[model samples]
Target: MSSGMAGANTEQPAGTRRNRTSEAGPAARRASRATDTNTEERVAVWDAVAAYVQEHLLVQKGVWIPTFGSFDTISKDIRTADGTVTLRWPVFQLARNLRAMHHLGSDKDSLPAHREVETLKYSEVAAAASVTWQRGKTCIQSTVSLLSNCLKNGENVAFVLKDIGVLLFEGMSFGIKYYYDFLEKLSGKEKFRKVVFKAPWLLDTLVSRVAPVASLTHSGHLVVFPM
Candidate 1:
């Protein structure tokens, strides 16, 4: 039996063995390359989405999706039944049209009595907001042009945007500084030390709000937003 096995092994050609190895090597290499490409594509997509969310949603305070919904953050500090304090994060709620399309019930009951979620269609809201942003951009552009023209003509131009608290074309810039200083005084460490530290209840009131049921998670960290 051993001699028979030896004869069979000897009969197997080296060229055939090399051919099999060469065939498997290329196929395995192709499969590995394909897997790597897919993984990279997925990672790229995830990163893009994360960046968009960070910039528009988190930084800008809110973002509206074309077909899905809007996302916004709401800070809420609350005490649990056992007296443990927790901060509730922001969450995304389904749009009215989306909810209706999915046959989901209205979220009116879940919302706070004092606040109302806009029920406008996504397209309408997006269009309106886009127009507003465009108008703001146009105003800024015109202001810049006016400033340039004034400077070129050797004239002093003082531009002020009351909403943003900005004074431009002046020797002193106070708009952003004043705004930031006000915000800092309102919510910064000094404010916390003087106000919240002395009156914890006021801090609780400032951060506390009626949260919706959808804003909770099993691990206690609320997911407030739907993917």
Candidate 2:
């Protein structure tokens, strides 16, 4: 009778182990299914949003989607010896998504958060400027002044363009949007007749400290010479 009781006790443990295994199998399968469903839903959402952006916002001017990226429509003015032509174009932005997903994942947080992202293709901005803001009298004056100064004084003007923003020449860079506008204005009217960007760094350093020159001395307007 004692030998029989010992055998029964050992058999009970085996029976219990089988029961536990059977119970866990269904639970594990359920958990896996939940994870898969969640993944599918997230993928669908992303796909829909991407499609919407491509369909609607792709043609608008300066239209940017928050946290995802931006879309821009840019116009340009062409100049030939005979006449001028204006052209408009569009481009998409996706840098913010790439930066957020890949760069900012670790503890060493270097990239800005998604909310801080302000997306614009540097080319679009430059093209817009060439179409619009470059036409301003002040902008034209500044450009002419700087270019003239560089040419006259034999100063080396460096254009440091890193493919992200406007054509930044030398130490300072101007936005492409404004540059485009300036170009358009030049195409429409004769530039450098009134003002020119002859010496930007020098003018900035001196004008900031010295009294304002009423006009470029060569123009013969009442002016204060930088003595």
Candidate 3:
């Protein structure tokens, strides 16, 4: 009797260990399943937005996404010496209410005051200007190439401007959406308009004029535009 009691004290019953494992297994599986479900839901939402934009673009010129902005397309015709070439591209405009969100100040006075602008000779000024122009051109070309690659590969891309906001592109038929902090701040005060207008590669032009390029990265097929 004493020996039997000692054995029972030293070892847990097989049923007891199995019951503990079974108890923890369900909880762990439940947590994992919850995480997977959340991820699936997010993907579903993204897919729904992509589907809506594709369908809208097919029937009309563009579509407006609430809490985001308007998306549209523009057509351009080039008259060359050989023949006329036509091209179509997409454009995004911040919602009218969100336009005031970004304050685009003049860069004319951005140069340092200590820089001798008036005392420079004409040749020196011209050379400096030429160098600046070449640098700008190279930057523009690189940015254009990044965007073109994204379109060609049908990969998702995102751009987060410093003063502006976030721009998201889902490359399945070229859908875009914009988000900003102001949208949330004024959420209760304003509503998104339903009107859609055919709005272009105009972004490339804008990027050239607006912010300086900061960083760029590509993961798998998706590209994150320069900040």
List per-prediction Cα lDDT, in the order shown.
0.29, 0.27, 0.32
Compose the digit string of candidate 3's lDDT tens values, residues 122-202.
233223334333333333233334444444444444444322233544423222322222222222112211101111222
Q: What is the TM-score of each candidate against the true structure?
A: 0.28, 0.22, 0.31
Q: Model 3 clash pairs?
A: 90-200, 91-200
lDDT of 2: 0.27
Backbone atom clashes (below 3 Å) for every candidate: 2, 25, 2
Cα RMSD, model 3? 25.9
Better model by TM-score: candidate 1 vs candidate 2: 1
Whole-model alpha-carbon lDDT for candidate 1: 0.29
Candidate 1, superposed: residue stretches over 4 Å from native: 1-43, 56-60, 81-88, 106-227
Q: Give the TM-score of candidate 2.
A: 0.22
lDDT of 3 at 196: 12
Question: What does the lDDT read for residue 30 in candidate 3?
Answer: 39
**Could you say which candidate leads in lDDT?**
3
Ranking by lDDT: 3, 1, 2
User: Among all windows of ten consecutive residues in candidate 3, which has the lowest summed lDDT?
Assistant: 190-199
